[model samples]
Target: MFSTGQLIFALFFILAFTVVLIVTYRKDKTIHKKNYKGFGWVGLGFTVFVIILFLIKHMLNK
Candidate 1:
């Protein structure tokens, strides 16, 4: 039930926000590559840990 003006403003805001986010990520890409090399491993480890916990809980419930 949004008015035409509100819809237009929302579209413009989303476009502007997306452009800013992309530009900021591009600018920071090099810094992130150098400083966060092991980040993927940490994420993977956490995911595995969560899966193990779920499996253990399911086994104990049975």
Candidate 2:
């Protein structure tokens, strides 16, 4: 069982960390958009490949 002070400190730490993370992401949003373009297509392709692999494995096991 944590004390009241420890609980308050934990809450404050989490809130501060979240605020900092949001601010950093907002500051870098433009750079990310410019640099990471087409990454989603790569992710999609990987996901599809994995699904196909699993389906093949399942079919072979039957």
Candidate 3:
């Protein structure tokens, strides 16, 4: 039920938000790399832990 003006506003808002996010991330890329080393492994471990938990839950439910 959005009007034409609302749709145009939303489009512009999304584009601007995306552009800002990209610019901000690029600016902080170096700092992020230095500070967040080993972050990927932590994320992987958490993911694996969650999957294992779900498997256990499923097995228990059966």
- Output candidate 1 Cα RMSD: 3.0
lDDT of each: 1.00, 0.99, 1.00
Predicted candidate 1 versus true structure: per-residue lDDT over 1-62, tens digit per residue: 99999999999999999999999999999999999999999999999999999999999999
TM-score for each of the candidates: 0.68, 0.65, 0.75
Clashing pairs in 1: none
The superposed Cα distance between candidate 1 and the true structure at residue 34, in angstroms, equals: 0.9
Question: On TM-score, who's better, 1 or 3?
Answer: 3
Q: Distance from true position, residue 50, model 3, in Å?
A: 3.9
Higher-ranked by TM-score: 1 or 2: 1
TM-score: model 3 vs. ground truth: 0.75
What is the lDDT ranking, best to worst?
3, 1, 2
Best model per TM-score: 3
* Tens-place lDDT digits, model 3, residues 1-62: 99999999999999999999999999999999999999999999999999999999999999
Worst 10 residues of 1 by lDDT: 32-41
Off by over 4 Å in 3: 51-62
What is the per-residue lDDT of model 2 for residues 1-62, given as tens digits with 9 covering 90 to 100? 99999999999999999999999999999999999999999999999999999999999999
Models, CA RMSD each: 3.0, 3.6, 2.1
Model 2 bad stretches (over 4 Å): 43-62
Q: How accurate is candidate 2 locally (lDDT)?
A: 0.99
